[model samples]
Target: MEMSRALDISAAGMDAQSMRLRVIAENLANQDTTGSAPGADPYRRKTITFAETMDRGTGQPEVQVKQIGQDMSDFTTRYEPSHPAADAQGYVKLPNVNNFVELMDMREAERSYSANLNVMQVTRSMLTRTIDLLR
Candidate 1:
């Protein structure tokens, strides 16, 4: 029962990290995205939040994505007179997503996902051995 609970917890963690990775990827992809119209806002960076909840059946804490929210930080502006999205002052609004930050976040999420996967693999191996011994 304990082993099953551990597996469940690890799986939940992996799921949460998977969603986080996806968000990071999206942010990276839109790092340079700008608004299509003048004075319009560009794409905003997405953020994921995780929350711990008790599993009713297993009575164990499991991680889940609480919400996916947008970054409220101010967008950077650049002078580009020829750009269609340029405002009256020839300033183009760029996305708030930072490449460096997105890369770092991707690395962290990858590490977390790997850790959860390792836990699941180890738990499965232990369960397999237990069954073999019983047989």
Candidate 2:
């Protein structure tokens, strides 16, 4: 039962990291996305927040995605007079998403997810060994 609890906790963590990875992926995918109309706002980068929550049944602390919010940081601009999204000044607003930052976040989320998966695997192995011993 205790091992089950560990698995549950790890699963929650993995779930949270999975969501984070998804957000990062989306940011990367939309790095070039821009508004179709001139002077319209471009795509905004998304951010994920994690919070520790107490499991109702086990009372164990587990990570959860608190929110998936937009990054309000200023969007980058480039002079592109031919672009459809170019403003009156010939400057086009770009998405705030940065490839480097998104890649880094993706790496971190992937590592976290892998770590949680490892914990679950180890816990399952221990449970199996215990059952074998009991037999």
- TM-scores for every candidate against the unseen true structure: 0.97, 0.97
- Candidate 1 whole-model C-alpha lDDT, 0 to 1: 0.93
Q: Which candidate is the best by lDDT?
A: 1
Q: What lDDT does the true structure give each of the candidates?
A: 0.93, 0.92
Kindly list the per-residue Cα lDDT of model 2 for residues 1-135, writing each as its tens digit.
Answer: 788999999999988998898898889889999999998999999999999899999999999999999999999999999999999999999999989898888888889899999999999899899999999
At residue 85, give the lDDT of candidate 2: 95
Ten-residue region with minimum lDDT total, candidate 2: 103-112
lDDT score of residue 114 within candidate 2: 93
Candidate 2: regions farther than 4 A off: none
Error of 1 at 135 (Å): 1.4
The TM-score that candidate 1 achieves is 0.97
> Model 1, range 85-133, lDDT digits (tens) per residue?
9999999999999888988888998999999999999999999999999
Poorly placed runs, candidate 1 (over 4 Å): none
In candidate 2, the residue pairs with backbone N, CA or C atoms under 3 Å apart (3 or more residues apart, or in different chains) clash, namely: none
